[model samples]
Every structure is written in structure tokens, then in C-alpha cells.
Target: MRRIRRSIGEYINLYNGKRPHSSLADQTPDEAHFGTVRAINSGA
Candidate 1:
């Protein structure tokens, strides 16, 4: 059970952090979200 949960968690992380989405202009979700935050914080 623990192994299955771990596998699912890893896949979720990979999907969000590594896989790019076409709707986001080919950026991974994390990159798309955090990049915008960084840009805003930098006042760029």
C-alpha cells in the first residue's frame, strides 16, 4: 500500500513539475505558475 501511494505521489510530482502543457505555452505547471510569481515579485 505504501509503495503504491509513493508511486502515485511521484507520478503526480512529475506530471506537475516536468510535463509541459500545451495550454500553458509548453511550460510545466510549476514553471508557468512560479515564473509568473517571480516576475510579479521582481516588478518586471
Candidate 2:
């Protein structure tokens, strides 16, 4: 059960943090949600 939970958590993280979504202009969910903050922090 613990391993299963960890696997699910990892997959969720990947889906949100790494996988790009076409509906979101090919940005990952995290990128789509925090793009401006990221750009500002990076001095873009």
C-alpha cells in the first residue's frame, strides 16, 4: 500500500510538473499556472 501510494504521488507530480498539455499552450500544468512567477524569478 505504501509503495502504491508513492507511485501514484510520483505519477501525479510528473503529470503536473513535467507533462505538457496542448490545451495549456503546450506548457505543463505547473508552468501554465506559475509561468509569470517563474519568468520573474528567473529575470526573463
Candidate 3:
């Protein structure tokens, strides 16, 4: 159970922090939430 929980947590972190989603215009959840997506594309 503990191992499963750890795996879930890691996946959650990756999902929210690292993985990009097409629904969010290929931005990670954190980037979409913080409005950093434009900055990334505009090269600012």
C-alpha cells in the first residue's frame, strides 16, 4: 500500500509539474495555472 501511494504521489507530481497536456495547449498544469505559457512561447 505504501509503495502504491508513493507511486501515485510521484505520478501526480509529474502530471502537475512536468507533463504537458494538449488540452492546456501543450503546457504543464503548473504553467497553465501560473500563466507562464505565454512567456515560454514569446521568448521573454
Candidate 4:
């Protein structure tokens, strides 16, 4: 159970942090995601 949980966490992180998105013009998830982060920061 512990091993399975760790594997799931790793997969989630990999997908959300490393995968690239065509919608973001070939940017990785991290960079594509940061646009939203920057927008929120600017709004605040």
C-alpha cells in the first residue's frame, strides 16, 4: 500500500510538472502552468 501510494504520487508529479502541452505552444506543463500562476500574482 505504501509503495503504491508513492508510485501514484510520482506519476502525478511527473504528469503535472514534466509533460508538454500543445495548447501552450509546446511548453512543458511547468511553464504552461506558470502562466496561470503569474496571472494570479498580478491580480493580487
Candidate 5:
């Protein structure tokens, strides 16, 4: 239960408000999800 709660918190931060994902070009996951992706060495 505790582990699950901790994972949920981590996910919320990583995918909703924190964690500058490289796929997002250093933007938060929420930004990427909302089409706010920036241009970086994405290999795209």
C-alpha cells in the first residue's frame, strides 16, 4: 500500500508537474502531452 502510494506520487510528479524528460526536450511530461514539446536533439 505504501509502495503503491509512493509510485502514484512519483508518477504524478514525473508525468504531470516534474521530471524534465529528454523526449520532451527538457519539458515536463505534461507539456509533451499537451503538444508543448520543444526542439532539441530528438533524433526526430
Candidate 6:
């Protein structure tokens, strides 16, 4: 049970703080949730 709980915690961390999602413009869920993304300006 402890191992399963630890695995679940790791998965949650990755899902929320590490893995980027296409629906979020490749931003991790934590970034999207916290509005911490920085915009890149390309010289046009």
C-alpha cells in the first residue's frame, strides 16, 4: 500500500508539474494552473 501510494504521488507530480500537454500549448498543467508561462516574441 505504501508503494502504491508513492507511485501515485510520483505520477501526479509528473502529470501536474512535468508533462506538457498539447491542449495547454505544451505547458505543464502546473504552469497553466498558475499562469507562469512566459511569451516568446519573434522579430517579424
Please, what is the whole-model Cα lDDT of each candidate in the order they appear?
0.98, 0.95, 0.92, 0.84, 0.74, 0.86
Write one digit per residue (lDDT tens) for candidate 5, span 1-44: 99999999998877777778787689887777655344354434
TM-score of each: 0.88, 0.75, 0.66, 0.62, 0.42, 0.77
**Model 1, 12: alpha-carbon shift in Å?**
0.9
Top-down lDDT ranking = 1, 2, 3, 6, 4, 5
- Give the residue spans of candidate 2 off by over 4 A: 36-44
Indicate the residue-level lDDT of 14 in model 1: 96
Q: Which candidate is the best by TM-score?
A: 1
Point out the worst 10-residue segment of candidate 4 by lDDT. Answer: 15-24
Error of 5 at 29 (Å): 0.7
Candidate 3: where is the Cα deviation over 4 Å? 36-44
Candidate 1 lDDT, 1-44, residue by residue in tens? 99999999999999999999999999999999999999999999
* Model 5 alpha-carbon drift over 4 Å, by segment: 2-7, 36-44
What is the C-alpha lDDT profile of model 6 across 1-44, one tens digit per residue?
Answer: 99999999999999999999999999999998777434333322
Q: Residues 1-44, candidate 2, lDDT per residue (tens digit)?
A: 99999999999999999999999999999998898798889999
Q: Between the candidate structures 1 and 3, which one is better when assessed by lDDT? A: 1
Better of 1 and 2 by TM-score: 1
RMSD of each: 0.8, 2.4, 4.7, 2.5, 7.1, 5.6
**TM-score quality measure for candidate 3:** 0.66
Better of 4 and 5 by TM-score: 4
Kindly give the stretch of ten consecutive residues in candidate 1 with the minimal lDDT sum. 12-21
Distance from true location, Cα of 13 in model 6, Å: 0.3
Candidate 4's TM-score reads 0.62
Candidate 3 on 1-44: residue-level lDDT in tens? Answer: 99999999999999999999999999999989877767877888
